[model samples]
Target: MSHPPMRRPPIFPITEAQLVSLFMQSFAFGVHALVFAVCMHRWFCRFQIAGLGTKSWPWMVVATSLFILGGVDVSLNLYDNIIAFVFFKRPGGADLQFETISNWINIVRSVLYFLVAMLSDAALIYRCWIVYAHWKPRWAVIVLPTLLWLGAIVCATVDVYYVSTLHKLATIPHEKTLRPYLFATYLMSLLLNFLVTGLIVYRMRALSKQTSSFIRQQRWNRLKTVSRIFMESALMYTLSVVISAVMEMISNDAFYGTTDVSVELAGIAFDLIIIRLWTENTREESRTITESFIMEPPPARPRLNSLGHYQLRFPPPPSRVSFAHSERGSVHTNISKVRRI
Candidate 1:
């Protein structure tokens, strides 16, 4: 008689899943580092060209903080993995180490993740505000998103408190008390990102329409290009949060992997916008220079007159017209006639 296959031990999946998460986290960290480097290079180039300013300082600080926090978070994850796989000499193996709710490294990683999410969301809101700054009631546009961000802050604080208070070694699935706060935090962030991104995109589209009549077709195309970039970057972070929230709700071990990726992706999303904008600005400047050179007028050639002397012919000056708008909204046009001697 054929024997039934032996069942796998509970520890098998825990160890395997954690290992997968560790590998994925490391790979993402590599990408994050490379992006961070490029971002810094672009920022420095901009600084050199434009010189130091208050507005530029804030962006540099934010990008640097995000990179530092991401690095620390990934390092803590690495330490936890090493402890679970190599140093922990216990009967339960890696599962015991991973399931320990009170692990210090795990607690720190959770806090870092929450911090990064908040920072990224705040940056998105700032971008939205900047885009709408010219509107009469600009603040009204971001009120809802700002409120959602505050709610997220409260949820994240509570979640961190709960995680810190857990004294026992237990599986995450069994922690019913913490699920609501965690879910709320992720849900709020998801909504905030959606709203902010939508608002920015709508504003861009509106501007495109408003300027279509007066602006060059090339400029309209540039606006579309910018809108596309913003959407692509925002979508990257939004999808990561969506996957994370879904995984967290289901209590899947894969949540660890996705959450790890989300941390790096948050920074990547923010930095990507700056990098792409800088590139676009550079391309536009180059194109402008090329057009100026191509459209430049040719030098006037010297002509030999009947007196055998070289003479240069100059073009006649054009008349000028100026428009003035009165307080009552009436426009007055004045034409200046050019007189030739």
Candidate 2:
């Protein structure tokens, strides 16, 4: 009798969702690289212009950390993808690999994301504090956001603990033990963003109103522009988090894509604020130099009168005063004074 034909081993196929996630991640990585390059260039330019004495060291540190972590996170992700798709000889394919929640790569990626979120939130909170530094009871203004940030830290810690302890075959989007903490972490971050953004916008509007009568129209416009930039950046970051949170809730593979994008978006958002402010400051300095050259009165010189005696000349009286707000929220008044002869 002829022997039964040998049965082929079953092949596990990757799903459309996984493919979509991979594509989106690749796209996001490319975009993130471009944005990161631009941001770094801007940051270096600012560093050169301002030197080491500026108060921007904290931001520089945060930006650098994000860049390094982002690179590592993406590198690990690519390695995981390669191992799963190219070299793995397992019966189950990439789908099983991607679904494994307790994988070391997955856990490390999650931790990197948590760190990014925390850094971004902390930077936003610091910005809020700087903006309200002049207010009475300044600490009171940031109390809520600070507490929420702490709560996020706790939730993330718990979630990571649970994730690390999961079984080898455990799947994501179905881990009940980790779900609540994950939800809480994202929710806390979302709420913190909203509250901080609102406080900052409110403070800016108040400053605008209080200075409306005395502040020049040009200065007022600049303040408004800064406020708008702050709002737009915050909104971009907030929307990214919102999308990622929604995807996570629905157990969509897009959550991986969006979450990765959000990590880069956080740095991008923070960098945008600094870039805009630095650009504006550069432009303002150039304009001021040009105006000084054009509008500066000639120096008073001693001249001989008809009486054959030297007479003293006096410069014109001061006509206007300008108020400039420093990065630290201090207001400076610049007044032109007549020279005494």
Candidate 3:
């Protein structure tokens, strides 16, 4: 008896893009959270067994904090999307269109995600410092990574200023004043990733060459593996950033959601350090086990028992024997007693 008036399509069909971003982000978050849990457990367990030292233990705390923060930020983003789809919109009026990408919630979420990246990048810089601190020219080696880290943070801060003040993201690239900062932020992040990753790889390989022990070489190799993983990860996220930025800059559409990949990968990179740490610690344990098997001492030679030494020859001074012979039978000799030996 009653029918609601039909509503026409809105100006934008970014709903599909929004949905794609939402579920992909959610899936990446869930997978990395699970990985973080597993890696955290293994990390602590291996640390306990393998002996947690001063230098690496503190970094472990930092890594955990970054992972936790990234998870929290992503959770907020998912909730923001849930609100957009489930609660914030009317069914018929202006609800036909997807939520705008530049909502305050999205802005806040993006800022937090960037904070996580900043923390991860800072950790990378710390690693570079520790690796090169003892070198001939220490501060000179540190200057580049330090600058990259600070530059990324500063650019992110400027970008955050814009994000906080605006409610729509599409206008960000066109705003002549803020556009350069936005581009610089992503560029700085990419640069920081490459710089720190290269430093780590170089330092670790150099360490491997300097150390004579097989175990130490293995340890360096493990650290180098972590650097490579993070580098690859950084490249992935950097590409996502590039694509999203390019698409938005050129297309004049509000449907570019590929930047979500960068958010997901940033979170994963933090937990990846833990995963690699666990691997390195377990490798040390395995090396110990192998060494034990190879370097065990030989068994001791026979010692004196209750009877006497078996090595020396013994001579009998006197002995008594009895011989018994039977018809059509073989003779047998039995020794009764020995007088001396």
List per-prediction Cα lDDT, in the order shown.
0.77, 0.73, 0.59
- By TM-score: ranked, best first: 1, 2, 3
Compared with the true structure, model 2 gives a TM-score of 0.83
Best by TM-score: 1
Candidate 3's residue-wise lDDT over 49-159, tens digit each? 534444356656775676676577666756765776677656642223233435666577667767776776776676666656556687787687677778877887877
In TM-score terms, candidate 3 sits at 0.72
Residues 1-341, candidate 2: write the lDDT tens digits. Answer: 99999955323223444455556666766766776677667666766664532556677788778777777877786788888888877887876787678888888988999999999899889888777765789899989999999999999998888787875564455456777888899899999999998887787666666556665676556667777888998999899888987876875556777887787778778777777776766676687789778776777899999999998887895565533444422432211100000
The positional error of residue 53 in candidate 1, measured at the CA in angstroms, is 6.3
Worst 10 residues of 3 by lDDT: 332-341
Which residue runs does candidate 1 get wrong by more than 4 Å?
1-12, 51-54, 303-311, 315-341
Where does model 2 exceed 4 Å of error?
1-19, 47-53, 168-170, 298-318, 322-341
Residue 333 lDDT, candidate 1, scale 0-100: 11
Q: Number of backbone collisions per candidate, in order?
A: 0, 0, 0
TM-score per candidate, chains pooled: 0.85, 0.83, 0.72
